[model samples]
Target: MRARLDAESRAAGFVSTGVCRPDAVPDIAAHLSTFVDAGRHGQMAWMAERMAWRGDPAALWPEARSVVMLAHSYAPQHDPLSDLDRREQGAISVYAQGRDYHDVVKKALKRVARWMVAEAGCEVKVFVDTAPVMEKPLAQAAGLGWQGKHTNLLSRKFGNWVFLGAIFTTLELEVDAPEAEHCGSCRKCLDICPTDAFPAPFQLDARRCISYLTIEHRGPVDADLRPALGNRIYGCDDCLAVCPWNKFAVEASDMRYHGPHRAPDLADLAQLDDAGFRARFSGSPIKRIGRDRMVRNVCYAIGNSGAAHLKPVVQDLCEDDDATVADAARWAVERL
Candidate 1:
């Protein structure tokens, strides 16, 4: 039954999996404290709560006997660097360009979890990013991939483009051995960060991370960092894009992950109203940020676009009811 699930995941394009023993839950808890104590998670205050449960999978769901970690590759089809020079266009991270990964990955995980339950007659629970599960650490311990210096997991087969998810079951499936660090002396992902988001190897400061600012941050972005954002209106991909190991990566298997909307125009995004934004980003992760935060992002792009014609767009945004959008729009207007 485990072999069948492995085959199914392999056929679906995931290259890694591992079953971590329930005892290893303590190791995950200990590592998580190091991250939280160091203040690397930024304003994600929830990480500080329920420390005991989040660190150990056994505590999260005492019924679980094994964890089946899964990774899906969403590597970009074309060179991401090509879009860097197109200042007037928005460069969304490849993962967020199409359907929300949580929806795609969760549906697939349910199938695998069901297969396990049928074979063993045991309970199962699946988790993606939404849960407090330390997926990267668990995946690393389970041998899905080594957590690279940028603190994101990197697979030998998929490089830095793999999206991680997990399924915990009461069934005791065969566990795979953990993988060893393969990063060696490479520091490209660290050196390429525009905001220097990484505080040290394998640790990230979310406040300086464009992905956090654009997606997780609720209000006005730091005025100082707006110019550094460049034209990346969505999640920033500089760290993932700069990884040298990505040369071995393959295009995504899911067709929903590809198409023209993969890269949208900055000017067009700036013009999206609440209704338009809702219709355009429906079923995509971008929709979760809502039109206001997205417009706040587009305003930053307009500032970096260097197109005087976009000045009107910024001016309009300055009058927006949301203080966050209006604040960003004023900053953008000044820059343009």
Candidate 2:
């Protein structure tokens, strides 16, 4: 069954797969509570909402005996941070540069999950990032990877750029031994963070994370973190980009959302209305942030840009109906 699981997962475009008992990660609840109690999850209230189901995947569906974890690669072919210098262009995270990963990964998961039920005559449930499942911890428990010092999964084979999907099944399979931490003395991922999002090794403060601020964060970002945001309009990948294991990352052939193209123009992005924003990001993960949040992020980038010519672009947004957008626009004009 494990051999067939690997073969099917590969055919479905996943780089790797592993199985573990639903209760493999015993400490997940403890870890989650600590992060939330410290108020480190920031504005992501959902993290605190599903404490029971999220902290215990076994409780999510009591009948499930085993969890199948999969890794899909989206490793970049070029330096993700190279665009930080392109002041005029908005630097989108590589993951959002192509098709929405939730769509792509969930479709593949459903495909393989259907196969699992048919072959094994067992009930199965599937989940992607949007679920309460703690995939990073589950993935590590399944032996696919380890949660690195930066608190993102780091795979020896696929590096830091892989997406995780999970399957819970009644058909118990032989579980693999969990992977051990290989990060060693490497502080590269930790030190590269522009906002020092990691409060300690193997710990992340989402409040200070650029990815959280640009995506999950609501309204205007804290004033101090605004400048460090630079031109990142969607999400930030500085920590992922600096991992030493990435040297071994296979640039995914099937994942080609990002390329050698220069960054998208920030001035152009700041000018987008809701309709234009939706059209531009129709199949993108960026669409979820909505135009107001996206433009608000762009306003911060524009302020950091020091591109005097773009003053008028942001000036037009100073009166945007969205209070956050208007405030950000005013801030950008002042910074200029």
Candidate 3:
């Protein structure tokens, strides 16, 4: 049953798959409590709201006997950090460069779950990152990979550029041994962060994280941290890009996930209205941030760009309807 499931998962476009009991993540509750209690999650109040389900998969679905974890790699062929040097361009994270992973990964999860049900005669439920399930720990427990010092899963086979999905089923399958941590003495990921978001190894303070500031965070960002944002207008991938384990990563099989959107011109992005923003990022994850938030990010990047040519664009945005966007634009104009 396990072997058949593995083959089905690969056919469904997942690069790696493994299984573990629903109750496999024993220390997740404690770890989560510590992280949240320390206010490390920043303004992501949803994490605190779903504490029970997020920490314990068994609690989420008591009927489930096993959890099958799957990983879909989206590694880039070129250097992910190379865009940082192009100060006039806005650096969007590699993950959001193409179609939204939520839509893509969810479709693949449904395919795998349907196969498991038809072949093994078992009831199943599929989950992507949208759910409160602790996917990384479950993946590590299933031998998919270990959580590196950056706190993201890292696999010898797929590196740090994989999207995780899961299938919970009533059928008990043979479980694989957990992958042991291989970070050793490496602190490359920790050192590369522009904002020093990491309080220590394997922990993150999301308040200072560029990804959180540009994406999940609402309202005005701190003036001091805005300068460090550089040209990254969307999510930041500094830690992930600097990881030594990424040497084993392969180019993504999904062609839709690779292209010029990786580094859009900051000036061009600054001129987008609400409708234009929607049309430009129709199928992309960047759409989730909405026009105002995205413009706010672009303004920050423009400020960091130091390109006098973008001063007019920034000055025009200073009268934006959205207060946050206007604030960011004013900040950018001052910098220019």
Candidate 4:
């Protein structure tokens, strides 16, 4: 079953797959502990509290003997960076431009897990960004890819376009050799960031990240970073899109991962009220951020849009009860 799944994954455009013992992650956890100790996670304090346990997968689940790391390719039909020059339009990350990946990836992992459990006779647990799993390191250990200088998992075949997920099981499976790092002397990901999110190579300062500020931070963006955000409404992919290795990636196989709905027009996005917002983002990850945060992001895009005509919409949002909404609205009005 394990061999079959690896073959299926490879045929589906996954560059690699490997079974690694849960213990394979202890060294990774120890290193990540150092990253947290150095205060690299910024305001995401959860990374600090789990310091002891986060460093080891065995500590995370004692019963798990093996972990199956999986990768799904989401190569964009066009260069995501190409739209950045259109300041009047928003540049949403390629992954978020489709159906929420949590739903899409998890469904695939579950199917694979069910097949494995039935054939191998063991308990199985699956995760795709919803748990305490150290996905990047585990993927590296599983030989799925190597950690790039930007600290994201990258592969020779897919480059940085793969989305990772994992399944941990009680059955001990054959493990594969870990991948070697291929980011020799490359600092492109660090240099291309508009907000200077990377403090140094391989270490990210989440607070300065446009993705963190626009999507995760629940308040007004730093006035200095607002202009750099341009019209990116949901999340920033400037760094990911610019990686030179992406040239090897093929276009996404899933039609849902393609087309304009994922990259909706910024002007249309700014007009969404609560109901409109929910309806527009029905099954995508953007819906999980709620109307307030989504609007907060939209207002930043409006400000960056230099679309003075949106002054009325910005003014109306000023009365929004959410402090984050009010603050962003004020910023948009000033920019307009």
Candidates' C-alpha lDDT: 0.82, 0.90, 0.91, 0.79
* Of candidates 3 and 2, the better by TM-score: 3
* Residues 1-336, model 4: lDDT tens digits: 667878766654445577888887667766786777776676677778776666777777799998989888888877788777776667787887877778777777887787777787899998898777889988988888888877788887778887888888898888888899888888889999998888788887788888887777776788899888887887877788778888777556566665355456666776677899888788877777788887788788888777788788788888788888888888999998
> Model 1: which ten-residue window has the lowest total lDDT?
253-262
**Residue-wise C-alpha lDDT for candidate 2, range 144-241, written one tens digit per residue:** 99999989998888898998999999998999999999999989988999999888899999999999999999988999999999999888889999
Off by over 4 Å in 1: none
Model 3 residue runs over 4 Å out of place are: none
Looking at model 1, the pairs that clash are none
Could you give candidate 3's per-residue lDDT for residues 175-271 as a string of tens digits? Answer: 9999999999999999999999998998889999999999999999999999999999899999999988888886675777785589998888899
The TM-score between candidate 2 and the true structure equals 0.97
TM-score on alpha carbons, each prediction: 0.95, 0.97, 0.98, 0.92
Ranked candidates, highest lDDT first:
3, 2, 1, 4
**Sorted by TM-score, highest first, which candidate order results?**
3, 2, 1, 4
Better of 2 and 3 by lDDT: 3
